[model samples]
Target: MAASSGRFESAKSIEERKEQTRIARAEVLRQAKANFEKEERWKELKRLRGEDTWMLPDVNEQIEQFSKAIAMAFSRKPT
Candidate 1:
């Protein structure tokens, strides 16, 4: 009977630990999502105010412009 009681106690402890871990992970995810939304809101506000928001340029466009500039520079032979 004592062995059965011990098993039951261990099972309960395991369940409690699992529940705690789940709660902690959920809280962390919630905080991360909130932070991301806040940042997006700030960017939107800046946009509405005609302020430049930091954003990455399109990689393909940048590459095309860079290639053109390099070609133009090379075409002009050193005087």
Candidate 2:
């Protein structure tokens, strides 16, 4: 009976170790996937920003253009 119990305990320990290893491996894989996704998002954003340069005009220029458009629209006095 004692020998059988020892064997059972050993088997249980082995199973526990295997489960722990599996959980650790799964965590590592999850972290790697997350990092890869984050990097991909950053890359996509950088690409969309257009060759490391912002294509939009300065704020003052944008405001000026908007004001001009508004003035033109008001002056047109309906088709």
Candidate 3:
């Protein structure tokens, strides 16, 4: 019974630590995004210039497409 209780405490501590790290990572990503907008770096990029900006493609979907294209290209045998 004592050993089981000790294992439970350790498991709880590990979960708490993981939750703390997850929150910290989310905060850092939020700050980085805010800094980018504050600097207007995206505005200077010509490709994004004069765009409605409100309408944007899903980033994850775009990345998935890119990954699939790369995989298809690499899977072909060299002549």
* lDDT against the true structure, each candidate: 0.85, 0.84, 0.79
lDDT string, candidate 1, 1-79, tens digits: 7776653457789899999999999999999999999999998998887576343557656887999999999899887
lDDT of 3 by residue, 1-79 (tens): 7776653457789899999999999999999999988668656664467363444568656887999999999999999
Q: Which stretches of candidate 1 lie over 4 Å from their true place?
A: 1-9, 53-79
Q: Residue 62 in model 3: shift from native, Å?
A: 37
- What's the distance in Å from true for residue 30, model 3? 0.5
lDDT (10s digit) by residue, model 2, range 27-70: 99999999999999999998787755554558657887999999
Q: Candidate 2: where are CA atoms >4 Å away?
A: 1-9, 52-79
Model 2, position 67, has a per-residue lDDT of 100
How many clashes does each candidate structure show, in the order listed? 0, 0, 0
Worst 10 residues of 1 by lDDT: 52-61
In the predicted model 1, the residue pairs found to clash are none
Evaluate model 1: give its TM-score: 0.55
